[model samples]
Target: MDSEKLIHKITEKKALKDSKELLDYVSESGENTKEYIRYKTLWAMLQTGNEMDEETINDGYKAVKRNVKGRKSSLYINVVKYAAIVVFALLGGYFIHFADFNNEIAMNEIFVPKGNRTSVVLPDGSKVWLSNGTKLVYPESFVGDFRNVQLEGEGFFEVTHDKDHPFIVNVGKHRIKVLGTKFAVVAYPDDEQVKAELVSGKIQFDIHLGGTGDNYKSLMVSPMHSLVYDKTSGKVYDSTIPDGFYDYWQNGVYSFKDERFDSLATKIARIYNVEIVFGDEELKTRTFTGTLSVDDNIYTLMEAFKIASGKPFEYTFESGKIYINK
Candidate 1:
């Protein structure tokens, strides 16, 4: 039997008459075919909720075993071995079903361009404010035990409250797990630091040092707290943020407290849709603590920098690029 027909039969809960043929196909199938079977079976089980009792599970095992009882071929032995996994996948969806497992789950990707900010209401009624130059990937409908999403750049999330299903955000090398909370995440691939600032409720921040599950450290983030991870040094530190600092950017104003110019330039470039070229290295070291409205033009924003620098600073804008010198 072909994989499609086999999957249809399984999904339809039809009694197995061609068990031997199915076993033969599974035995000769490659890894991808096996994975497809597992994914389809799990998806079907989720939809139908065909909970199998202990007796049924045991009966399935016994039936498969009896089919291969007198067969001495190594291929039959392999089939018997693989049948156990297939049985479990059909009976109970207990295996590792990652966010990428369900091929049928529709994915929606939203990109907020360099000069614009946008907001999206997820299917679960969660609201997300995507900052400029942000890429957010989420499913049309969340399945399984977690609401998983991927974010590049920055975003503010107000996740819907679901105690049973935690909301997880994958940002760079870190994963932020939350349960109906409002938080902000900054994790640009080009940046040296990744930060997760919690506005309310609690979250768990996990830093995967080497992209391996075993080499990771977890931090319990509380309300009004910011967890910063240095990508270069593999160091993590937690500090307190102001009451409204996290969500301030949503209103077209950015507030920074003693933020370095070099670090701030990335955000400024993204918000203003301009490339900032610093001719003087010293300008990168300057730190400023203030608020700037994103609605202002590039010259106005550069004038603010000049006043903050307390020195003669000049800039030239040409073809969407700003060259700054002091």
Candidate 2:
């Protein structure tokens, strides 16, 4: 077929008589013609006001086959051309017509470094507040059996639950299942423990870290409840989380009730992107019980600790390290 004839057929001005010749021409056309044929045929098939039949659909496949594989140089290549056309046809259909792909898909990822905070929305109508040095992966659209997302570092999730599709948040070695619930996750690699604090509704916490992973059970809880799974202890501690603790992230406050200095420092490190070294082993082992506002800089937060402990902490802004002295 001539170039003009090809264009006429693509423009739908001329009817496709021999689907074989049209297919061959599409298969051997140059890059520009190949793209034109691919998009034009796609638009022809999918565009509103057009009723696509088998011949036009076959032409669409032929267009994709030609565009994806360029020109064949051998007889064997020609023999396999039909199979390649079928593959491209199915793949193109999935890409353009798949409903799941059209909705809540994670198209990009955002990372929040330590000493920072970020807010993000998932494909579902859920909101997530990512704590410092956290990574969240989500789709641009939400489809399939469950609305799921993977979380690293720490984050607070306010999920908009769909009864047909449960929202699943995957933290390191732990999974939170909820339909519509608000909760916070504190899990850092440097820390020996992971915590999930529920603010409202109910959540199912699955402890996936154990000798026999399948032997572990799931714990269901409501607001003011918490589940702390410790890796070193091989235990999941359930407790009534203290008031004001759940709102810490939102209010720029961090509350610790008799939490050891080492664990507390780990949390601070993730939030502030700072390296805290304890000079005295005893001081590092000391436990702190109080509430400090993170709104101020690290120095100010340390000052609060100093008054509570009756000790002074000297930190160097240049070195990003802190020292406790009595």
TM-score attained by model 2: 0.63
How many residue pairs clash in each candidate at the backbone level?
0, 14
lDDT of each: 0.70, 0.62
**Which residues of candidate 2, in runs, are more than 4 Å off?**
1-107, 209-216, 311-318
* TM-score versus the correct structure, for each prediction: 0.67, 0.63
Taking every candidate in turn, the Cα RMSD to the unseen true structure, in Å, is: 16.8, 16.2
Tens digits of per-residue lDDT for model 2, 170-279? 77657888889888887766677878889898889887845655644688876888888888877888888887675576766877788898878877876676777776
* lDDT, residue 153, candidate 2: 72
Which stretches of candidate 1 lie above 4 Å from their native place?
Answer: 1-102, 243-247
Instruction: Give lDDT tens digits, candidate 1, residues 46-144.
Output: 332223346655676677887665645654544443454457544432332223423445355655567665565665778777667878777646788
> Model 1's lDDT to the true fold?
0.70
Q: How many pairs in model 1 have backbone atoms within 3 A of each other, for residues 3 or more apart or on separate chains, i.e. clashes?
A: 0
Best by TM-score: 1
